[model samples]
Target: MKKILLAVAALALTAGMGMAETVRIGTEGAYPPYNFVNDKGQLDGFEIELGNELCKRAALECTWVKNDWDSIIPNLVSSNYDAIMAGMNISDERKKAIAFSEEYTPPPLSAYAALTPDADIKGAVAAQTSTIQAGYVAETGASLVEFPTGEETIAAVRNGEAEAVFADRDFLAPYVQESNGQLVWVKGQEKVVVGEGIAIGLRKSDTELKAKFDKAIESMKADGSLNKLITKWYGPEALVF
Candidate 1:
């Protein structure tokens, strides 16, 4: 997915524009490090923490909303929440339906994982629904199996339901490292380093909200908190700036 700027004027009716004080941050509570629900049944993750910090820096009253990743954007268009803080990439196609704040996290590669290093991923690949990695798998010779959550995609490979799992490298890194020699990043898969920066998705009409978040992101970058959080969650080698 390549990054593209959004046109807020085209989405005038999509934002909860009048409420300058309260903004509901939407996220998929299934992706860890980026976002997830803790054992306490409360939303917690890097995105949640960063979102709260942004709200705090912007002096805005904010609340969190959990939504399924597949329908996250549609629900946002329906006013389910004020903005989306999910680890969503800012793409040209998505920008048609919503706007985005300047990217807070730089785009990192999406990689493939399998039980063995040389697994034949020719016709069996798994990816989360509606993700760029899913689209990539679909275009490959692989038979694309879809799942609603990131967890399920990885599980598919483990259970022999799919030959390989495609997802963000950072998200899949821990799984590979924890698997001992059981799992590894797929080698010679004819892959391309595909992805764009991750940013907060907003209604195309929410210029005020977009401006607020952009300023917050810029502030965090300037103060080095953005890089700090990246390293904290995705490790030292993760992309910064």
Candidate 2:
């Protein structure tokens, strides 16, 4: 009886261990609408909600970790977290560093915002470092001023550090509206398409984890819940899968 009881307890312990595996999700809690530290001082945003739902669907125990945008990838690669759900766009340059799950968002419009409508975007443009927008600005021959955060990039324009700030139109739209005419889109500048889309970042070796999220995302797309969440956070005009 003692031997049989011991074997049964071992089996139960093994099963519990399997069920308790936790996946750590890393994000930059600074990008609003996408992810942000809300008024409650807790991580809250579109990604926060979507990520939690994805974990539930995948049946994976998950937790959130906040990291700076520039270091988010490095930390993930170093095993500080299991995945990245920050508003990171899927790009070839980034793929060299980490693998990505299926895109959750379509290629978003990139635009320039400046204090004046006539501001010359070609003169100087600010973009967050390590972002595709920064790379775009660099290729355009405009002086590229890189900041570590999206907020600083916008502040660069407000404080005259740069002629304009180039970033995702969705991220910039709220600021422009709240600026009360102090900031406006640079006229005559066409919005450019950037990246493939936003997706979860994972280490290449974590194919199993990536597959789980991809499956969850596909289900959301099929059921239209993903579109509802996108529209809820990004507004009705947001692109949906």
Candidate 3:
């Protein structure tokens, strides 16, 4: 009986070791509240913790690596990473290049207008899509200024270079508040402008990894673990889906 028990333990240990697979996760450390670098130069945020949790649940060794948002998909396609955990939206454009797991966050893509206390910014945003440039051009009748990322778009509004910007509502909320409410959403524009939520980006060919991530995300959602994490950083309303 003792020999049989020892043999079972050794087999279990070997199986566990064989199951250990390192998964390299790529994220844009620039997007705050989702994934970003702290003052201490360490990566931190909602997505970072979520990724680690998924890794744990999936029983995979994990390494989180930061990549520029624009290059994230390319890096994944180039085999630089096994997955992407950045707050990337699941859009038709992106889907052509990469696959997405079940959506993790369902935050809306919405428009934000710069408030001058007295200026009417509505008519400006009523025409364009939920994009800062489109809104800026429509409302201010000025040429749209291109910004590389969400942070830069907010900065443009703060600098008065642009009257407003557009981004995922959750991503823009904290910044708008921190900017002293200089930014406000264009009311009644919700049903008209923005669509649904965001999803995780994955390499196009990584079907197996995609399946594992989808299962992991479903598990997170089912266990109420995702709710706790969102509530910690974004509050209840942020989980639209």
Best candidate according to lDDT: 2
The better-scoring model by TM-score among 1 and 2 is 2
Regions of model 2 farther than 4 Å from truth: 2-7, 10-20
**Candidate 1 stretches greater than 4 Å from native:** 1-20, 188-192
**How many angstroms is residue 191 displaced in model 1 relative to the true structure, after the best TM-score fit?**
8.5
Task: Encode model 2's per-residue lDDT on 80-121: one tens digit a residue.
Answer: 999999999999999999999999988888899998888887
TM-score of each: 0.88, 0.95, 0.79
List model 3 lDDT by residue over 79-153, tens digit each: 998888877666666667888888887644554555553334432222223233344345556455665567777
Over the stretch 28-82, how does candidate 1's per-residue lDDT look in tens digits? 9988879999999999988998999999889788999999999999999999998
**lDDT pick, better of 1 and 3:** 1
In terms of TM-score, how similar is model 1 to the real structure? 0.88
TM-score-best of 1 and 3: 1
Look at candidate 3 and tell me the lDDT of residue 111. 49
**How many residue pairs in model 2 have overlapping backbones?**
0
Work out candidate 1's RMSD over C-alphas: 10.3
**Clash statistics: count for each candidate:** 1, 0, 1
